[model samples]
Target: MLKQIGNYLKSKWSVRLMTIFYLIAGFNHFINPDFYLPLIPPFFNSHEKINVLSGITEIVLGIGILFYPSRKYASYGIMIMLLAFIPSHVYFIQINSCIDGGLCVPEWAGWFRLVIIHPALLLWAWEAGKSSS
Candidate 1:
């Protein structure tokens, strides 16, 4: 069973799954604006516009990744997007609470996301991009 799972991970299906995941996430940005608006730091102007733009970008990249010719470009875009989000994650930690009065977790949970989950997410994108066949 492990070998089968490993084989799937090594296949293009993994990339497709990643793309789908992002597409859904991006779509949610529009579907649930309130959820994302709180995530934007106060320093940035036009939070709503920024959220819209990011959502559109994610949709574009996610769709671009599905095509063979654009796969590499989309993967690169995804990587860049992920990297760009680091500051937001930091901001989340700095605030030490859920943005927009959402559910608040302990500071350690925020730190764990920054220190662990974020890197793992980046690595997942990197590996998918690098291993594209």
Candidate 2:
């Protein structure tokens, strides 16, 4: 099963799909800034600098992942970024804060993020590396 999954990810469609996902996510960082604002850690709210930095990072990382030479690094960077954001998710759940003025993001959302999204991201990164190699 693992080998089959690996073989499937080696296809061009998989790479393109992963790239598209990053592109959408990166673009949405700007298009839907408010949606992500609540995910920022409170400690960084001393001023608005953190928000700008986060947006810039997302855009850069997204672009980096699209380029063949930098895709692997970008994948690693994205994985790191996702892991780093886990605390913010935890904080959101603990404080019962609404995500983008909507109802609180369900507790399971965080778990899904950690278990599903993060691992998928890591696999995407591995695929990126395989393509580059």
Each candidate's lDDT (Cα)? 0.78, 0.69
Poorly placed runs, candidate 2 (over 4 Å): none
List, residue by residue over 30-123, the lDDT tens digit for candidate 1.
9999888887888999999989988998899888777777777777888898888877788888887565568578888888988998776666
Where is the poorest 10-residue window by lDDT in model 2?
45-54
Candidate 1, residue 58: Cα displacement in angstroms equals 1.1
Model 1 residue runs over 4 Å out of place are: 1-10
For each candidate in turn, the TM-score is 0.84, 0.77
Candidate 1 lDDT score at position 72: 70
**What is the overall TM-score of model 1 with all chains considered together?**
0.84
Task: Please report how far candidate 2 places residue 113 from its true position, in Å.
Answer: 1.9
Point out the worst 10-residue segment of candidate 1 by lDDT. Answer: 2-11
Steric clash pairs (candidate 1):
none
Q: Candidate 2 at 129: error in angstroms?
A: 2.0
